[model samples]
Every structure is written in structure tokens, then in C-alpha cells.
Target chain A: MKSFLKLTYMELKLQLREPVALFFTLAFPVMVMVLFGFIFGNEAEELLGGYGQVDLSVPGYIGMVVGTIGMLSIPTTLANYRELGILRRLRATPLGSSPVLWSQVAAQVLMTAAGIILLFIAGLAIFDLRIPNGNLAIVPAILLSAFSFFAVGFVLAGVMPSARTAQAVGMAIFYPMLFLSGAAMPRYIMPDFVQQIAGLLPLTHVVILIEDLWLKGTWNLTSVAVVAVVLILGLVISRFTFRWE
Target chain B: MTQVIEVRNLHKAYDGVTAVDDVSFNVDEGEIFGIIGPNGAGKTTTIESVIGLRKPDGGSVSVLGLDPQTEARKLGNRIGTQLQEAALPERMKVWEALDLYASFYEKTVPWEPLVEQWGLAEKRNTQFGGLSGGQKQRLFISLALLNDPQIVFLDELTTGLDPQARRATWDLIRAIREQGKTVVLITHFMDEVEALADRVAVIDHGRVIALDTPDNLIASLNGETQVLFSVPNGFEAERLEKVSGVTAVHQHNQHITISGNGPLLANVAAALAQHNIAPADLRVQQANLEDVFLALTGRTIRN
Candidate 1:
């Protein structure tokens, strides 16, 4: 256990040492959120043209926050380690191999939380986006979304072992989740068939749960339950199929 | 001497091709044992299997009397290994790598002395990717000794090193042995086997073909010596073969070659004197490990 924590701390320190990656991990998502928020502010409703009267930019920004931290950052880092034999070297050490995986998960979780906080701060300060009326529900929504996306990232890292493949696969999942989950475009604007397929995606469910907490001040139990199920499924699949070397 | 490592009928196959086939050897305490083989001859696979990096299909391997397969985590603290082609992160500095690996063990030698002893103090802050191959090899060796382990495993330690670096590494390996640590060195360099190994097992096609000291293996070849000399004008190959202890003679232009077992040089000189032919340059060379390897395996070590 001591070795696990020590190795995890080392990993976290190493990740933070890369100035560019660190900046992008923390600052890029917030920059995108603020840029999109200012560009789409007040004009969001006008552009929506009576799509349930909900401010479209709020859900869009939330989805962006989830997608950047979850989809883009996680898979690339995991796959790079596997390809370079860093994971294999660590596994040969006395430190149990699970610590490396868990430490990465922990780093992503911490980074995701920071990114979400920045998004929230930017939304509240610049865009005048108010906190959800049902403040208690937002916690579970964010937590579930983080876990679900992390699991997706884990499975993606496992299946696509190469760094190039991880990037391609991350982008492949990222564009769809970004566009289809109402991050860039409103989900209400999509065709019914597209919405049905998008609804099956974990990102879609995460966005829906976040939208419920942030905009409506209510807990959507069914959506939260779906997110929970997807999180479990992703965890199991990654655990069984993950190849270290 | 007590056996520190023991393997019985170890076997490993990858995708239906056997990498290690029924190989067995033992390393006594404080002895530098080597497994010498050519490329793709299962040296790395056999060492990794003993270290528990790869599971053997059929075998019994015990390190310090602990089963590596079941007690890998526990045994890892006691064994130091420098694996072939294994690398750390590019941006990881030498000191960072050292500190990180040191943290994995319960008790670790201080990094300062290791850095000094390995001559890496100047590059401690440099990233791993920035170092040259010899520097990286030194750092790997430092990490392998960081835990102050009772046994160390080095795979192809001097594969790409220059002659100077190779000799320095050989000295360091001897230093490790002097410190009373048993070592398992895997290499294809016959000179390395001759210089450092106390006993060597020659592996070919995943099996041990011969095992003994370097001198014993050479002596076991029945004392064949190669004698070469530049014959003067008017010297014939037939006249050289008639010399005592000269079993056969082959000549190319002015150079004469003779193969024999006993009193070769003296008899050749006597015969040359009788023929009034004094060779300009006379030289006799004894057989080394390379000759023994070729004779036993029917293939040179490089091949």
C-alpha cells in the first residue's frame, strides 16, 4: 500500500512536470468553455428557436467539460504508457500493477474535477449561468459522469494499445459525443433516429443528467440509473479485457 | 556453495514456437553465471521466465527457494533485474527514475553513492531520452543494484556498447560479484563469457549444449592449435607437413598454415631449418571460446 501511494504520487508528479500537457489538461477545456460561452451568450436562445426554452449553451458547455477531460486526455495517456513499455516496467517492480492503473484513474478524476470547477466558475461569472436549483443532485450527476467517462477511457486505452490508435479512437468517440450529446449543437435539433442512438451513448446520458441538475433543479432518477449501469459495464469490460504488455 | 537459483526442465512457447525448451541450470551463491546464446536463441525468454515476467508453460523455477510465479511481488523486492529493451518515460530524469525505483523496495541503497559510483552525477538532472546508449545502460545497472539485492539479472548488458564502455561494465559486473551478490548474465558475446563468467551454459535452440568454465571448454577440444607463418621464397607445403607434430599443412602464396596437436612450433622451425627456409613472420594462436562454440554447435556464435 505504501508503494502504491508512492508510485501513484510519482506518476502524478511526472504528469504535472510536462508544462504543455498540464496546461492543456487544466486550461484548454476552460478556454474552450469561456470562448464558446462568450460567443454564444444571449444569442443561444435566439439560435435555439423555441427548443424547450432551455438555454442551449449550458448543456453544451457541460458536455464539453466531460468530453475533453474524459475522452481526450485519458485514452492517449494510457495508451502511450502501454506502448512505451513504461507500464510493463512498472509491473515488474515490487509495486502491485493495479496501483499504476488506479493512480492514472485518480489523476484523471482529479483533473476532471478541476476542469469541471473551472467550467462552473466561468459559466457563473461570465455567462451569468446560475447554479442548479437542486444543488444536491448536481454532485451525484458529476460523480457518475466522471466515473462513466473514465470507464470508457479505460476500455478505449485497453483495446487501442498504440498511441496513434488511441488518438484516432479518442477523436472518433470525441467528435460524436461532442456533437451528438448536445455539446456543440442542441440534441433537440437532431433527427429522432440520431437522438435515439445518441441516447444509448454514455456521454448522452451524462449530459442529460447534468442538464437535469443544472437547468431544471431536479433529479432524473432514470437517467442517473442508466449512467450507473454504463459505468459498471465499462469497468467490467475494461478489467477483463485490459492487456498490460 | 548454496544454490541461489534453480530451474528444472523449464519450457516456454509463444504462438506454437518454443522459445525455451527443457532448459535447466543453477547458480551458486556469489558466482557470476552466464547463459550465452545467439540472437533469437531464447536467452531473454529464459531469464524473464525466472523473473516472473513471463509464465513458463512447463517448469519449476525457484529463486532463493521462493517460487517466482506465486511469490512474484514478494520476490521482486529481493531481486534486481535489468531487462532488455525496457525503458522509462522520456522526460523522466535520471534522479527521478532512481528515486522512483528506490521507493518500490522496503529498504534501498542511497542514490547519491550509486550516482557517483556509476559516474552519472553530472547527468542526474538530464532526462532519460537525452542520454546516450552507454549512459542509459549505466543507469539501468544502477537501478538494478539500488535494492542491494542478493541476486541480480542482467540481459544483454553490453549489446550496443563501445569497447571502452563494455570493459567498464565488465569491471562493474565483477565489482558486483566482489560484493558477494550472485549474478545471472545473459549474453552472446563469447569474450564476455571468457572474461567474467565463472561457469557458462551455452544455449542453442533453447537448450543447453555445453556447460563449463571458459578454459575447461577450450581444453576439452583435444588441444588443436593453429600455427601460421609467412614462408620464405622456395618453401613448399609438402615440406612443411613432413615436420614433426605437423598433422596437415595448407599454403596460400607465401603464407603457410599448419594444424597440429603437440610441439607444433618447434617441429615446424626444425623442418624450416632443415629446408634452409626461415619464415619471415612466425605466429602461433591458441583456440578460444569461439572455436569451442563452433566445434560443439556446428555454427559460430555470430551465426
Candidate 2:
């Protein structure tokens, strides 16, 4: 238990050391939120189903936070360690490899949560973001979003041949989802066919689910079911694809 | 001497291809036991099996009198391994790596002194990726020694280092032995075995072909020696074959080569002097481990 904490702490420090990853996971989301918040203030807009622009976009940015950590951070770290034989080295020790893995997961979760908190504070301070209507389901909805995306990241980390490949694949998947899933831009403005494709993405479900819980205090059943299915599939695929060396 | 490791008919295969065939050897306490073989000759597989990093399809291995397969966790605490391809994170600092690994064992030596002893004091804060090859090796040794283990396994420890770094690593390995810890050194380098190991197991094609002290293995060659010198053109070098301990003589223009056993050099020199012929470049080439390996495996260590 003590070693787990120590390892998690070290993992966080290492993640912090990577400037690019730090910026994308923590700073980028807040920057995008601020940019959109300034351009379109918290005025109720029919284009956003009557919710204010910042209020509606805040939930989507939170999805972006969860997606960045899941698609970028987790896969890159694991694939790099495996490529370098670091995971195999740790496995040979008395502690074995499980602690390293668990600690990594813990650190990523903490970083994602921290990113979300930073966005929340930014929205509240500058844009006077509307609070969720006391729906406790918002907490679980955010956690579920993190879990669904992280599972997909693990599958990518397991299957990718190297760190560079994992990063490339993650970027290929994440950028499209970020924009088309309405996490970066409103999907309502996109073409009908593009919106149809966005509906199939897991991040789309995370965005819709979190927004529903945050704005209307009601669960979107289809979003919940889709995210749950993605979580299950990612878990199953990672089991067979994961390689220590 | 107490035996700390024993293996019996160990066998392993990967994807239906044999990696380690019926192999066995014992490591005695307080001695550096060397396992030498060419690339892809199953040296790493043998050690990994003995250390419980691999499971053999047949036979058994015991380290520290504990079954390596079942008691691997317990054995891991008592043994230190610096594997051939294993590495730490590139961005992991030397001190952080030490401190983190030190937490894995139930008992550990202070890492500060360990880094100092291994000449990694100055590199304590340096990231692993930034260190030179020699420094990375030193940090690995320090990590292996952190648990204060009774046995240490170093596989191909100095394969890529320069001559100076190799010799320095040899000294560090010797220091580990001086602490009364049994060391297992694996390499294909002949001089490494000659310089450090008390006994060597020559592995080839997934089997133990020979096991003995370095000198004994070399001597097992029946004392084969080569005497090379240049004779005058058209000289009858064959006449020197009758010299005591001289087995055969070959002449190639001005060059004469003699192969025999004990004191063949002196006999050939005396024979030449009696003919009033002297060669300044005369030298005796004694059989070493490389010769022994060639004689045993019918191939050189490196392809």
C-alpha cells in the first residue's frame, strides 16, 4: 500500500515533467473553454437547447479532459514502457508489475480529475457557469466518462506496437472525436452525415451523457448504454492485446 | 563449498521451438559462476528459468534451496538480477529509481551509499536516458545490490561498453564477490571468464557442453600450442617436426608454423639455433577459452 502510493506519486511527477502532455490534458481544455466563453458569453441560446454557451460547453470540455487523458496519457506511457522493457524489468522484481500498472492508472485518474477541477474553477470564476441542478448523478456520470475512455486507451496501449505508434493512433482517434463529438465545437452545426458519424463515437456518448446530467438532472439512457458497451468491449480487447515486453 | 543454486535437466521452448534444452549446473556460494554462449544460444533463457522469470517445460531448478517456480517471490527478495535487455524508464532519475526499488524488498541497504559505492553519486539526479552506457550499467548494478541480496545475476553486463568501462565493471563485480555474495556472470566474452569467473558453464544450442574452471577447460584442449616464425626461403621447416613436443610443422614460403604441446616453443627455438637460424618475430600462442569453445562447439563464439 505504501509502495503503491509512492509509485503513484512518482508517476504523477513523471507525467508533470512532460510539457506537451501537461498542456493538452490540463491547460488546453481550460484555454479552449475560455476562448469559447469570451466569444459567446453565458447567454441562453436556443442553438444549445436554451442552456448558456459556457454552461453547455463546460460539460463537453470536461469530456475533452477525460478523453485527453484516456486517449493520450495512458496509452503513450504504457506502450513506451513496454517498448523499452521497463515493464518486464519491474515484473522481475519482488513487487512484480501490478503495482506499476495500478499506480499508473491512479495517477492518470488523478490528473484527469485535476484537469476537470481546473476547468470547473475557470468556468465558475470568469463565465459564472450555472451549477448542475443538485443532481448527484453528475459525479458518477463524469467517472463513467473517464472509465469508458480509459478502457479504450488501454486497448490501444495494449495493441500498439510502440510508443510512437500508440501516440499516433491516439491522436488520430482523439482529434476527430474532440471536434465531431461536440466536445470542441457544437455538433448541431455540423452536416447531417457528420453528426450521424459522431453519434457512433464513444466520446459523443460521454459528452451527451455528462451534459444531460449537468444541465437537466436526467440520465440519457442511450448515452449510458453506449458508454457502458464501450467500456465492456475495451476491457475485453485489452486482455488479449496487452503485452509486457 | 555450499551450493546456492542447482538445476536438473531444465528445458524450455518458445512457440514449439526449443530455447533451452536439457541443461544443468550448480552455483557454489562465494564464487562467480559464469555462463558463456554465443548469441541465440539460450544463455538468457537458462538464467531466466533459474530466476523464475521463465517457466521450463521440463526439469526443475532450485535457487537458495527454494523451488524457483513456486517460491519465486521469496527468491526474488534474496536475489538480484540485471537482465540483458531489461531497462528502467528513460525519464526516471537515478535517485528516484533507487529509492523506489529499495521499497520493493523487505530489507534494503541504504541507496545513498550504494550509489556512492557504484560511482553513481554525481548521477543521482540525472535521468536514466541521459546517462552514458557505463553509467546506466552502474546504476543497474546499484539497483541490483539495493536489496543486499545473497546472490546476484548479471547477464551480458558489459556487452556494449568500451574496454575501460568493461574493466571497471569487472572490478565492481569482484567487489560484490568480496562481500561474500555469490555472483552469476553471463557473457560470451572469453577474457571475462578468464578474468573473473571461478567456474564456467559453456552453453551452445541450448545445452551445457562443458563445465569446469577456466584453466581446466583450456587445459582440456591437451595443451595445444602454436609456434610461429619466419624461416629463410626454401628452408626445410619439416625437419623441425622431430623436435621434442613438436607435433606438426607447416611451411608457407618464408613462414613456418608449428603445432604441439609443452615446451614446443623452446624446442623449436633450440632446433632453429642449432641450424644457426634466428627469427625475431617468434611467439607462442597458448590455448585460451576461445580455443576451448571452438574445440567443443566446432565453431567460434561469434559468427
> Interface root mean square deviation of every model, in Å?
1.6, 1.0
lDDT tens digits, residues A77-137, model 2? 8999898888878877888767887798789989988998999899889988777666778
Model 2, CA-based lDDT: 0.91
- Expressed as tens digits, the lDDT of each residue in A1-245 for candidate 1 is 66666666766777777776667666765676667655655443534443222244555566666666667677888788888878777877778777787778777767766666776676667766544454676766787788888888888888885978987888887887778877666787799999998888777777888877776777778778888887898899999877777
Model 2 lDDT, residue B226, Cα? 95
Q: What is the C-alpha RMSD of each candidate to the true structure, in Å?
A: 3.7, 3.2
Which regions of candidate 1 deviate over 4 angstroms? A17-24, A42-62, A121-129, A133-137, B229-258, B262-284
Name the lDDT of candidate 1: 0.82
Per-residue lDDT of candidate 1, residues B56-168 (tens digit): 99989999998988999888999999888778888889998998888888899999899999899999999988999899998998999998999999999998999999999
Worst 10 residues of 2 chain A by lDDT: A129-138
Writing each residue's lDDT as its tens digit, candidate 2 over B271-297 gives 999999977678888989999999997
